[model samples]
Target: MSRDGTGVPHSGGAAYLGMPAFPRAAETATRDDRLRANLRHATHTIRAKRARAVAELDDWARLRQAGAAIKDRTLRHLDHHLVRLEEAVTRAGGTVHWAADAAEANRIVTDLVRATGEREVVKVKSMATQEIGLNEALAEAGIRAYETDLAELIVQLGDDLPSHILVPAIHRNRGEIRDIFRDRMASWGRPAPEGLTDRPAELAEAARRHLREKFLRAKVGLSGANFMVAETGTLVVVESEGNGRMCLTLPETLISVVGIEKTVPTWRDLEVFLQLLPRSSTAERMNPYTSMWTGTADGDGPRVFHLVLLDNGRTDTLADEVGRQALRCIRCSACLNVCPVYERAGGHAYGSPYPGPIGAILTPQLRGLASPLEESLPYASSLCGACFEVCPVAIDIPEVLVHLRERVVEGGEVTIRGTRTTIKPAKRHTAERAAMRAARWTFDHPGALRRGQWILSRSRRLRPRRLPGPGRAWTDTRELPAVPAESFRDWWARTRGGTA
Candidate 1:
């Protein structure tokens, strides 16, 4: 179990543990040609579209600031806002359930669906559901939850975890998808109608036909919301595919599982987020399907609406001053498209529902930084600031990454079999720490740094392409810099034609 400050034993987030550091995982991912090609093509295409979409908005900066401010204000009084939302939901004929953790949340949803005596439930693409592993929990309870979102359906059919937030199957190309649809679609339900080709329309038709059965037949529909309005107790979901519209409205029992952080103080606050989220996420001017329900409307959608306000390690994250900003994520995969690390390594390597720069900080925070895998996530970034630049809410992801790394190093005391002991900072990173400390000391004393530089220049010939000890493995994979005979100080002196 990964331990952060919460001291809660995490059982579900085990996927992000006991893995190699970023460099190793990235190396493995980069070698896979299919994965690389898939990621490169998807990211580049999305990035271009996102840039154009953002450019169209004249008040994008203002909208971004407004989104951030509203979130910050909501978070400041989150307890108050949540209570208000609960009241609004109940008044509007909805049952609101609070989940303290992932297990509780899954249990509530499972029981809710079980009460309806339905073995199969259809799902819209909801990150909150994935975060809590709702499908796995449902399966354990003798129920099967089907993902109806096109990308989610592909990921589900492939028996693979989501690699990208928006396009979960971004790691899969058209060929891979066609293969999945042809082979896997039949077993689930409404198999490909005769000959299903790789063409976009054919694929859409196959999926539409397949999902239409679930939409019409299923008793329960599960979804996650983009925002929850405290003022009106309305949950909003903006989607490209009309499938979300169907799921939200068609089911007899509609269950929405949402993160606590995805709340707004008022309906007006949604105005800002609506503008920011679509452009930042799908690169769309307006989402094709915008579904907002104030609890249950009479003679309209689902008569029974269940809203699960899920904590699931969110309070722990909120406790972090630096990391709490991660909750500001509208899940606009804009950061994923621009992240160099994600482009090369893809999303599966992060081993969480969330991926890319946001995932690096978010997974570690939610799951805690006790395991090697969680610890490695913080170091996954190049600190290029590209993610921050593109962020609609302006979350400083690099700052959070650095902050979490410091926490990992400093806050590693754990009781092993009742004996409290401090696990030394990751064994591999000790040399890095030592080197950094030495550099810091030299930099602090200019005279010592100058002398060290001169000595390094004199002993340039002694430098090896590969370093000794554990560092040798690092150098073996990377280029060693060629030490110059003359140091920067000497070069500057020569340029000036003067010497001490």
Candidate 2:
């Protein structure tokens, strides 16, 4: 999931290397009945469980506040926390590398692994790695990276990209997974045990057996931590299966590449997030595996450890006041699960490694609203606000979504040199902009608006129930509200002399 030196396409706005906007992508996805069904079932199940889990915690609000505060404080003092984190890792016999962006991060990790003289590395599902596209980068460097997580394994074997952050294979069903395993399993290390069934246990056992050998033989294991305790200089990974534990502890050299935003000020702050994260994400009171490592622990685990703190647009993201809250996200995917849009369109439609509501805002901020895909992402949401409510770190996803939309719409109006220019709007959103401009003009001139309303009322019978031209696509699936015979302004004018 390494980034291709060129910033990964921003979801929905700037199409990656010239792709269609979110509406077009979603229209295509909606046509895929299998994809829609997979998304519907997966999102609903996760959303429901998340709702129930959230309901059980009376202290949830406090916890959310605590999580937000910790993150805010850490980010506010990120430079210091990071330096502290580095010192701790070094003192504990670990190495620290700073990556300015994805390209550097990938190059650093690739070189680090190459230095180890290992052609293959086993990975714990890590978003940072995916964000930087470590797997793809490693591949280009002639190294093979194996995904040890079940869902990641499924995606890797199927030659597919992750749709959901937590459940990378959320777009895939059991049957699809079975087929992927049956078809592609042997090509990568150990084959699936014979007679593997799609039943959860059988499939899991086969994966376990397949990955166990790699875990033992691989000299390097790469991961992303859910939380990096800045004060204690420890890294923490919370996982549902024991696979993360295996990856974290197995290899002779462990490389953890994490976003700078993942740091927390103290261990106690970590305690608050630990409580909030599992329930918000996996809906578990406690995860099956809680692996924490403070550098190397003598002969117990990896003798050599390296922690890569990756920026990759984070500093740019931090520069935006309104959008910076997105940095608080814990990669919970609660927002993704509860997203109505995600349920229908699925993850790939978002285009970046991160998907759904969080991705809609975060990706564009991290990558900037430069690309067509980045520009399109801000409008991806229905603004349902479900994502904001479910976020463990209390990121205001909808607020950030709109903030980014503003950035996209206003990008051309302001120059990097602090001058102004008008960039042509995309062909897709031109009509939308025109309509909005017309509405603004009408609202500003009440007298003309009244006359316009009277005319519309007289011709109400001729009004089309469906939108015309570009809008027809929007109204095709959604019912356009029937226009009333008289505008609300007209009704008010007649009843109250327009001023009452």
Candidate 3:
């Protein structure tokens, strides 16, 4: 298989094209004991801390509601906020660029870096950039974009895909990280110091030393914001480490590629998220570094600032009434921590940069259910509702998953890249549809239903332990519930004399 510049198999522009469907990928992921161990440890630890952090707030529920409301209000009038933001940014000596899709966003960023005459740029951790494969695009253009965040740096050095939203290297343990640094650090730039250990501090020190040189020497920096305040043209990036601060401030030129959904109407609206995001995400009262900047400042920070307001299917996503709530995601990864499906199946199974429950809903809507991968994502969950409960913005992910499943089963009109097109129901579900139709027929006729139930009750002892043929797969890891010897109506008739 051919690989992209990033060394992962080419996923065909933003969408995970070559990857297997969710069920196939997840089946494979579940067998990896080591991967499961890593995910179990990391997710358990993070969620426990989050529980403590959330307990510190008496008004967390109210805060969550406020955050959700703020996001909804902003998304409802995104155009107005975007125009206001563009004007505010321009007034602050910043240039704004708009990108309609992933390809266009990559092209604009590549051109901007080329125009600066810089071959190397340092990057803060940004999901928007990852979604567009910005590093791979830059590599194609003969430019090197170094990841400055520790986890992101590990992923880059290891040539691995990110498995989690906040901790990209969540699937890798300390020992694995030590191996990556010891083996790959020199090729990138700085070599790991002699005999580097896997101790947390030593690993962090190695990454810091390695990234420090890039910070000082790089002429340009790239980032994505946690929040973009339209009222003041302010962009905020909250991090446990100060890498984002360095990337935001140290470079001569800074560029931010942010999704339009990240916008907030006012600074007061921004305040609601600041309070909710920390407790929900890193489980901290406040991030160690909360950097907010309003464009450029003379003789301070980056002399030149550029904000790329990227659409990239967000406008189409906003068109959806039920799924649009996913736009409220702050990329906190709280849902991933609480999700049982994510814990077992892992992030790679979803076959997109966004993963877990949010990915199940968001990826299909953003990219459309055109491929088996996208179509299968909506079925990636147990509909446990854990993700919805933990979400700071209350996105109700389970509702959207069921909604997307309906879309997959009974295809209809959908918006794709600003065009509405009709799609046919998936052929793969023919057997399922047939079974449902049979069930409907049996239920509609009272005599047939009664006879069927009586026959099932009489033959309960002779029922097969596992289903035959295609259903064997479903019964492989699950037990088929035993049927009762008596139906409820029969019991009622026998015990209570129903006619009386």
Top-TM-score structure, candidate number: 3
lDDT of 3 by residue, 1-500 (tens): 34422223533233355888989888888877678778878887898799899879877767877888899989999999999999999999999999999899999999999999999999999999999889889989999999989998987887778889999889889999999999999999999999999999999999999989899888899999999889999999999888898999998999999999999989888778888998888999998989989989988899999999998889888888988999999999999988888887888788899999998999998888879999999889865556876789989897788777767877777889998888788878766556545554765676897786677667766867779999996545333222334554575467542221
Instruction: Tell me the whole-model lDDT of each prediction, alpha carbons only.
Output: 0.80, 0.77, 0.84
Worst 10 residues of 3 by lDDT: 4-13
TM-score of each: 0.82, 0.82, 0.85
With candidate 2 superimposed using the best TM-score fit, by how many Å does residue 137's alpha carbon deviate from the native? 1.0
User: Which lDDT value does model 1 have at 52?
Assistant: 93
lDDT of 1 at 79: 95
Backbone-clash count (model 1): 0
Q: For candidate 2, lDDT tens digit of each residue in 339-441? A: 7788777787777788899989987777766667778888898665557656788787866775555556534442222223444555456556655455557
TM-score of 2: 0.82
- lDDT-wise, the better of 1 and 2 is 1
